[model samples]
Target: MTPTETTTDHPPRAGAKEWIALAVLSLPAMLVMMDLTVLHLAVPHLSAELAPTSSQLLWITDIYGFLIAGFLITMGSLGDRIGRRRLLLAGAAAFGVASVLAAYATSAEMLIAARALMGIAGATLMPSTLSLIRNMFHDDRQRTTAISLWMMSFMVGGSVGPLVGGALLEVFWWGSVFLVGVPVMLLLLVVGPLLLPEYRDPRSGRLDLASALLLLAAVLPVIYGIKKLASDGFGWLLIASVVIGAVFAVLFVRRQRSLDDPLIDMELFRNRAFGATLGIMTAATFAMMGLNLFVMQYLQLVHGLSPFRAGLWVLPMTGAMMVGMVLVPVLVTRIRPGYLIAAGMAVSAAGIAVITQVGGSGGFDLLITGTCIMAVGFTPAAALGTDLVISAAPPERAGAASAVSETSNEFGGALGLAILGSVGTAVYRAAMDTDLPTQLAPEAAGVARDTLAGAVAVAGELPAGAGATLIQLARAAFTDGLQATAAVSAIIALAGAVLAAVLLRRVRAGEDVEPNSDDTAAGQVTPNVVAT
Candidate 1:
C-alpha cells in the first residue's frame, strides 16, 4: 500500500468533541455497575415493605443480573445491525421508565418485573458505550486513555453503590435506590443523540432470531445455576440447570458456524491476543470478586460495623483503583501491556497475602491496607485488558467483542462466588461442628453450625459463660474461613500474573496483535505499533 493509502485507512485522532462525548457515555456505564450492587443494602427494607416470600425475594434481587448476562450478546449484535447510538437512546429511555416503575412498585412481583426490564435495558448500554469508544477514538493511544477513564467509572460505581444506597435508604424508603437511576438515564436520552456518533457495520447481515433465543437459553440457565450454587450449595437441580445450559450453548455455537451472519463472530476468539486477554480478565475478576465477598461480610459481621460504615472502609480501595487508572494510561505509553498486566497481578497477589493475616477482631487496618494494595495491583489488568479486547477486533465487530469481554467478567464473578463461597462454608461448618457447646439443643446446634449469623443469634439465648465461649469460637471459625478464601485468591492472582506475562510477551505497547491475512482482506484496521 502507498503511504497515502495507509494514512487514509486509519481514522484521525479523537478531538475535544470526542472527549466530551466520552464523558456522556460514561454516565450509563457507571449507572449499570451501580445497579448491580445498589440493591444489597435495600433488601431488608424492601422485604419488610413488600412482604415477599423467600423465593420471591431472591428473584427480586437476582433477576436483574440474570437478564443482563443473558441478553448482552444479543443486544451487542443487535447494535451492529441497527445503530449503536439509536439502541443506546432507546435502552436509556426504557431504563428510565423501568426505574420509575421499580421505585413506585407496590408489589414484589411488580418490582421484580421492573428490575428485569432495567437489566435488559442495562445490557445495551455497556457494549454500545464500549463500541462507540472504539469508533470515536481511532488513534491507539487516545483510545487506550479513553478506555481507562471508562473502566474507572465502573470501579467507582461498584465501590460506591452501597454507600449511595445506604445514604438514600437512611432518608427515603427502599424504593429510593431504584429512583437514583431515573435522572441519569433521562440525561443520557436527552443528550446522547446530540453528542454521540452512530456507527454500525454496513456489511452486517440480518440478526437471526433463532440464534438470539438459543443464546438466552444458553446463558440464563448457566448463570442461574452458578448463582444457586453460591447461595444454596450443591444440588441435583443446580447441576441439571448447568447441564441444560451447556447443551444449548453447544447448539448456539454450531448454529453460528452455519450462519452467513452469525450473532457472534467466532473469528474474534481465534486471535491470540483476544483469547489471552479474555482469560486473564476472567482470572483476575474471579479472584477479586471472591475475596470481595468475604471482605464485605467480614467488615459488617466481625467488626460490628453498620452497612454504611462498611461501605466507608471500602473507599480507600476504590481511591487506589482511581489512582491506578490515571497512571496505567500513562505507563502503557512506555511499557508493554504484558509486563504491566503481569506486574499488577503480582502486586494484587501480595495484597491478598496481607489479608490472610487478618483475625476475627481488630483487623480493620489490615483489611483496608490489603484491599487498597490489591486494588492498585489489579488496576492495570482492568484498564489495559479491556483495551486489548476491544482493539483485537475490527471496528465493525467491536460491539460483539465488547459483549464477549463483559460476559467473561460476569461468568468469572459467578464462578468465583460459588467456588470460594463453598470452600469457606465447608471450613466454617467443619470447625463449628466440633466446637459447638454440648449443652445446646439439637436445633440450636444445627443453626449455629450453618452460619456465623446463626451462631450469633443462637449465642444470645445461652447463659453468659456459654454464650461468650460460643461467640468466641464462632468468630474464630469464620476468620479461618476468611483466611482460607484469601489464600485461594492469592494463588489465583499469582497464576494469572504468570499467564499474562508468558502469553502476552510479544504484544507491544499501545498496539494490538496484527490481524491475519483474512482479517486484512475483510477490512480490519492494522494497529499502529509504537516503537519500544
Candidate 2:
C-alpha cells in the first residue's frame, strides 16, 4: 500500500479507554527506572546486612543491568510473537516475585540471583510498553504525546528514586527499597489485563533460539566490559571481552540477513528516518549520561553537600526536562523534527560549554544553570527521536524496533560512562600524582590518587593543615577532569546536531514519509509518519 493510502485508511483514533490504559502501562515503565536508581542508594545498607565479598557486591550491583541488556532483544521479539500485553503481564508477575525474593534474601548470592531475574523481567517491560504505545496510539499526534508522557515518567522515576530510597532507609531496613516495586507491580497485574489491549504480529516467525543466544553473547560481554572499564579502568581482559562481543554481534547480524524470517527486521535500518533518529538519540544520551556522572560526584565530594540536599538541587534540571518534554508535541506541529532536534542538540552543546567553566572551589550556580539548560536542550531529541523510531517501523515489528532503540540507549549510556569516566580518571590521577604532599606516606598517597573519595578519606588522617591542603589539591584535580569531560561532551553534542541536520533535513513536521519504492520492492513495510 502507498503512504497516502496508509494515511487515508489509518487506524481509528484512540479513546478514553485507551488513554486510561496508557496510565496503566506507565506504572511498569516508571517502576523499571525506579528499580535502576533505587538500588544504588541501598548499596551500603545491603552490604552491611549481606556482608558480601567484593566480587559478590559487584555482581549484586552490575548483574541487573547486564542481564537486562542481554535479554531485551530476546524479550522484545518474544512479545511480538506472543502478545505485548501478555508478555507485559507475565513480566510484571515475575518482577513482583523477584522483588519479594530480593527483599527477603538471606544471603548475598540469593540477592544476586533475584536481581538477575529482575533484570530479565525488567527487559520485558520497557519494549512492551513502547510497542504497545505504538499499537494503541495510531494517530500521529496522539502517539507523539503519549511517547512524551512515557518519557516523562522515566524522568520522574529516576528523579524520585533517591528521595524515596533515602526516606525508606531512615525508618526501615535495606529491603524496604525493594518492596516499593511490589505494590506497583501488583497494581499492574490486576488492572493491566482489564485496561491494556493485546498486540502481536500474527505473521511473526517462531523465536529463533540461536539468534537469542547470539544476542546474549554479543550484548552481555560488551556491557560487562564497559562496566568494568568504568569501575576498574582499562585492562586486557576488558578489551578482550569487548572484542569477543563484537565478533558475536557480527555473526548475529550475518545470520539475520540469511534467515527468511529474522529475529529483528534488518531492513528497518535501511529507512533513513529510523536509522538517523536512533543515532541522534544514542549520541544525545551519551553526552547526557557522561556529564551526569561528574555532576553528581562534584555535588557531594567537592561541594560537601548532603545527598538529599544535592538531590534537591537536581530538581531544577528534572523540571526543565519535564517542561521540554511537555512542549515538544506542540512544537513538533509547527517545526520540522529534524531542525527541532538539531536545535535541541545545539542548545545542549551550549549548556555543556557552560559547564566547562565550572571551577573547583565554587560554581554551584553555573553547574545548576548549565545542567538545566542541558536538560531542556536534550529533551526534544529524546521525546521526538523515540517517536520517529517506532513510527518508522512497521507496526508488526514495533516490538523489535523498540528493543533496538532501547539497546542503543544502553550502549550509549555504558559507552559514555566508560570512555568519559576513563578519561576523567586518567586526568585526575595524573594531576594528583604530581601535586600530592611530599610528606605523605607512599600508600596514603596512592590511595589519594585513586579517587576523590579516597583522597577525602586519606586527608582526614593527616595533620589539619596538610589535610586541608590535600583536599584542596584533590578537588582541583577532580574539577580539571570534569572540565575536560564536559569539553568532550560538548563536541559530541555539536556533532550530533550536525548529523541530525544533514541526515534528517527531509523529515518535515506533520507529514508521514514512506519508504521509497526500493523498500517496497524489498518487501519492507512502508514507514508511517505522524500527522499534525
Candidate 3:
C-alpha cells in the first residue's frame, strides 16, 4: 500500500461521475438491506412452506442480523487492510452466490445456514461503501451531500423491501424474493472496479484474528439468545448465551486493549462527538426497528389488512425518510448538527407519543401521519450521525468507524425487536387466559401472538363467535403492549437526543480539534487548515 495506492482520488465534488458512482455503489448496498426486510415480509409464507417450528422460524429471520453484528468490526478492518474496492467486488460476488443458495434452500436449516453466509457477505458491503464515500467526497458540502444520498438509499431500501416482496410473491414463488439480488450484484461486480477508487491502509497490519474471534464469540450469542427469547421466551440456551456473552465481552475488551493492531480503536469511546453520535445512531435505529414491527402488526391485525396493503399504509415513513435525507445536508450548513440531532429525536419522540395513543380502531391516516413525522425527525439524526462519526475519525480508520456505526445499527435493531417485541408478546399472551378452549391447540394460540398477521390467520380458521372474541382480545392486548413499548422507546430516543446534544456542544462550537490526527497520512486536513 504505497502513498499512491492509498491516496487514489475520486471525481471532483458531487459531479455526475461521482454521483453515478455513489448510485452504483449504493445499489448493491441497498440490496443487502432489502434482503433483510424482504424476507421479513415473506416470513409467514416462508414459515408455512418450510414447516419450521417457531424457534426455527426465528432463527431463519434473525441469524443474518446476528452474524452481521458479530462480524462488522472485523470485516471493516479487513477491508482497510485488503482494499475496500477489492473487498466490495469480492463481497458482491459472494453475496450473489449466497443468494442463489438462499433461494434454493430446501429446509429451515439450509436457509438458516445460507442466511448466515449472506450476512457475512452483506457485512463486507456496508462499511466499505460508507468509508469509500467518505474517501471519495473530501469537500465538506460535497461529502455531507453524498452522505444524505447514502442515508436515503438505506431508509428507502428498508421501507420498500416489503412492498417489493409482496408484489414479487403475488407473481412468483416466495424464493423469488431472494433472486432480486442477483442482477444488482452482477452490476456491482462489473461497474464497481472502474468507478470506485481503490484504497488500503499502508500502516495497517495483519488483522487481529484473535480479537476478531473474541468479538464474534462475544456478540453472536447475545443476539442469538435475544432472538430465542423473542420467539419462545427465556430458557436455558438463552441463559447460556447471556452468560457467555458477558464472559466474552470482558475478554474481547481486554484483547482489543492489548492488541498492537486492534480490530477497533477502543479509545474512540473517549471522543465526545464520536461516542454520542454512535448513541444517536443506535437509539434512532432502535426506535425505527421497534416501531416497524408494531406498526406493521397494527395495520395487519387490528385493521384486518393484507401484507401488501399494510406495507402501502406505512409508505409515508419511507417517503419522509427520503425527503429528510435530502434536506439534512442543506440544514447542517444553516443549523448546528447538534441542534438538528436534538430536534430530530424530539420530533421522533413526538411521533412515538402519538403512536402510543393510537387505539385498535384508529384509522390508517393516524399511522401514516405518525410514522412520517417520526421519519422526518429520524432522518436528520441518522445522516448527521454518520457525518460526525466519519469526520471524527482518521481517514484510514474510516472503515472501522463505519463498522462501529453499523454494529450499533445491527445490534440496536436486534435488541429493539427482541426486547420490545417480547414485551408486546408477553402483554398479549398474559391478557389471554391460560385455559384457552381445549379445542384451541397451544401451537395455534402461540401463532396468534407471534405477529398480527398470524393472529388474523388464526382468526380465519376459528369458529365465528370464538374467533371474533379472541381477535378483539388479541388486538386490544397487542395495542396495550405497543402503548407501553412506544412510551419507553420515545423516552429512550429523547434521552439519547439530549445526550447527543450535550456531547456535540464542544465540537459544534468549533472550540476544539478532533482527537485522531493520524489521518494526516491519509489526506485528511484539519478544519480550515491544511495537512502537515
RMSD (CA, Å), each prediction: 4.0, 3.5, 4.3
Model 2 misplacement above 4 A: 1-11, 510-532
Error of 2 at 121 (Å): 0.2
lDDT computed for candidate 1: 0.87
TM agreement with the true structure for every prediction = 0.95, 0.95, 0.89
Residue 528 CA error for candidate 1 (Å)?
17
Any runs in candidate 1 off by more than 4 Å, and if so which?
A: 1-11, 514-532
Local accuracy of candidate 3 as per-residue lDDT tens digits, 107-219:
99999888988999999999999989877777676888888888877876777888889899888877889999999999998898778888777677899888888889999
lDDT of 1 by residue, 1-532 (tens): 2121122556588888899999999999999989999998889999899999998999999999999899998998898878789889999999999999999999999999999999999999999999899888877778888998999889889988998998998899989998888899888888888889888876788999999999999999999899888888999979999999999999999999999889997877777678889999999999999889989988877888888898888889999999999999899888888889999999999999999999888787899999999999998898889988888887667888898899999999999999899888888899998787788999999999998889889999999889889988988899899999999999999999998898887786545565452222122454332111
TM-score of 1: 0.95
lDDT of 3: 0.79
Q: What value does the lDDT take at residue 460 in candidate 3?
A: 86
Rank by TM-score, highest first. 2, 1, 3
Residue-by-residue lDDT tens digits, candidate 2, 1-532: 2222153446568899989988888888888888888889899999999999999999998888888889988899899889898999999999999999999999999999999999999999999999999888877778889999999888888888888888898999999999999999999999988888777776677899999999999999999899889989889979999999999999999999999878887887877778888899999989999889999999999999988787778889999999999899999898888889999999999999999999986888999999999999999899888888887778778888889888989889999999899988989999998998899899999999999999999999989999999999999999999999999999999999998888877776434345552222122243442211
Q: Model 2 TM-score? A: 0.95
Distance (Å) between predicted and true CA of 394, model 2?
0.4
TM-score of 3: 0.89
